[model samples]
Target: MTRPIAKPANVKARTRRRQVSPSLLRAALVLALAASCAFAVPVVLGALRPAQSADGAGLPPVQVALSGLAAGACMSLSPSGSNAGKTVFIDPGHGGMDPGVVGTVGGRQVLEKEVTLGVGTRLAELLRADGYRVVLSRMADSSVTKLSATDSVAGAMTASAVHRDLVTRTLCANSVDASVLVSLHFDAFDDPAVGGTETFYDAARKFAAENKRLAVDLQ
Candidate 1:
């Protein structure tokens, strides 16, 4: 066979240089990938996380803020002799299965439960703003009583469901040692013509005078 022509000197020199090993190449690629991931992870996580205030504080949920005003926990508006020491219990009448009244306005349903709850919630907010502690009998359209398995069972256990609900509301007010118990309800009359705000208090209550004054103020 004829002898092969001699390769170019530059090509021979390049061929003689040490080639990069496959293992080293793979290790370099892995290191590059790891570095990219290390830089990207915290950025992705921070974007996905809930936003914090500039001071790194997170806000309380609305429900928690509304329901947090228990006895002795109210933030006082004044340094001394504020309404902070007083707790008020608000009862939104007829929740759950007990819709107190039903009316139609402009072809839309007007539920007393919803109305009472709305009023109670607004009143609670107002009172809390005035530095008073507030507790609601039912925070939403739900029963305040921790009842039995069934309505009948609950009724049997506590005489009647209506009575049980009333008792539960009273107990809640007492438990919180509320300065005042405001039971909110919408009135319905047989004669649609008669409509006005009316407030009543138990005549036998020891603080009947104070109750009357409260009723008058409310009216």
Candidate 2:
């Protein structure tokens, strides 16, 4: 019969020591939940508020009140006035040579790239105000990665260029060890009548279930 060796007193004491503080754990949980809520904010804003219109004018009293509540909810939750160690990655879809889903609004062109960038910028601000480190794929109306000579063919991005551009966004998120990534995009269709919001996640990912949950929450 084999006898089990007893651990040393010092080793046992070390093992009993807590690696993470309860307060930090709670802060992480709160930040995660708040990040999830951030996804729905821009979508609601886009629907209720008109593009290029800044003031609350023309909006109903209830919507204005809801907007205020949303803003308040996005405020810092950390007790120390800083997020324990959480980072959020915001990817604004379609920029540079590819202006996605262009449409005319108020007798002017409204580009999807512009809309996504605007929402992403605002979202970043909110997340930062909430004490999270925010990383944006692109701050301006430009590609996340530098364009190569072959990247643009006749003013349009080639397939390889598009692939590289997308990969760069993923790399950016991974580089920061982002707790969550929110990619802003607007739905477009040839028919002018189609309109609604939808959220998507990758089924092939290891965290597919969690991704689906986030998507559902965002939706």
Candidate 3:
């Protein structure tokens, strides 16, 4: 029963929006969506007609940018080429049960889970090369398990923890000596007209600056 709430101001981006043909106008909008990826919810599109809604269901709606971190924030850190043996959590944002965002890239539809996995793989390789102990929430694609109807970040964390805990016990032994949890997810918005790459962490976390620094470094 969860859905995105529209931000009427977003519609103002287009002044002469009515002048364009329905088809052409749709394509322009899609291009805008494809260009961005982060935020509370993002709707990305590529050069194409109306972004096709996947399986009929779609992403969340656009909100005024919260200059704050989001829960289930996917973090990234360049291997300092130091920190060897430090357990760094490389949390791939969405997984099997959840296909985070559904958007088109170059006129072809792309799933967020796959994209997250691809980037996550590259990140793991980079971390491994740097000699950091990398822990993935799930090595293979799997649906994110839901704990309750709350649909809060805890749901995401619980889903993620399910995967990470297993890895920790089997591999890293449940400790992050200098641990950095990096989660990755694509954006989705209600209008099918928002997009951007953004990173976040618990704003309450004392070291949020550190997380932001790493995210900025990637940008």
TM-score for every candidate vs. truth?
0.60, 0.62, 0.47
Best by TM-score: 2
The ten-residue window of minimal lDDT in model 2 covers: 26-35
Winner of 1 and 3 under lDDT: 1
**Cα TM-score of candidate 1:** 0.60
Model 3 TM-score on a 0 to 1 scale = 0.47
Candidate 3, 64-175: lDDT as tens digits: 1112213222222224345454545555555654555555657776766787778777777677567564545455565323233443363454545545433432232122
lDDT for 165 in candidate 1 is 73
Q: Largest lDDT belongs to which candidate?
A: 2
lDDT by residue (1-219, candidate 1, tens digit) is 111111232111111111333222211010000000001112222222222222212222121122323222211111112345565667777776666566555556666678888887777767765656565777766666654566545333334766777766665565544567777876444333334454545445556566656655665
Candidates' C-alpha lDDT: 0.48, 0.51, 0.41
Model 2 sits at a Cα RMSD from the real structure of 20.5
Across residues 1-219, which tens digit of lDDT does each residue of candidate 2 receive?
111111232111111112342222221010011112122222222233222122212222121112112111111111122443565667788788878656566556677688888888777667655666555777777777677677899999998888877776665555445567777765444333323444545556556666667765764
Model 2: pairs clashing at backbone N, Cα or C within 3 Å: none
Each candidate's root-mean-square deviation in Å?
Answer: 35.1, 20.5, 16.7
Winner of 1 and 2 under TM-score: 2
Candidate 2 ranges beyond 4 A from true positions: 1-81
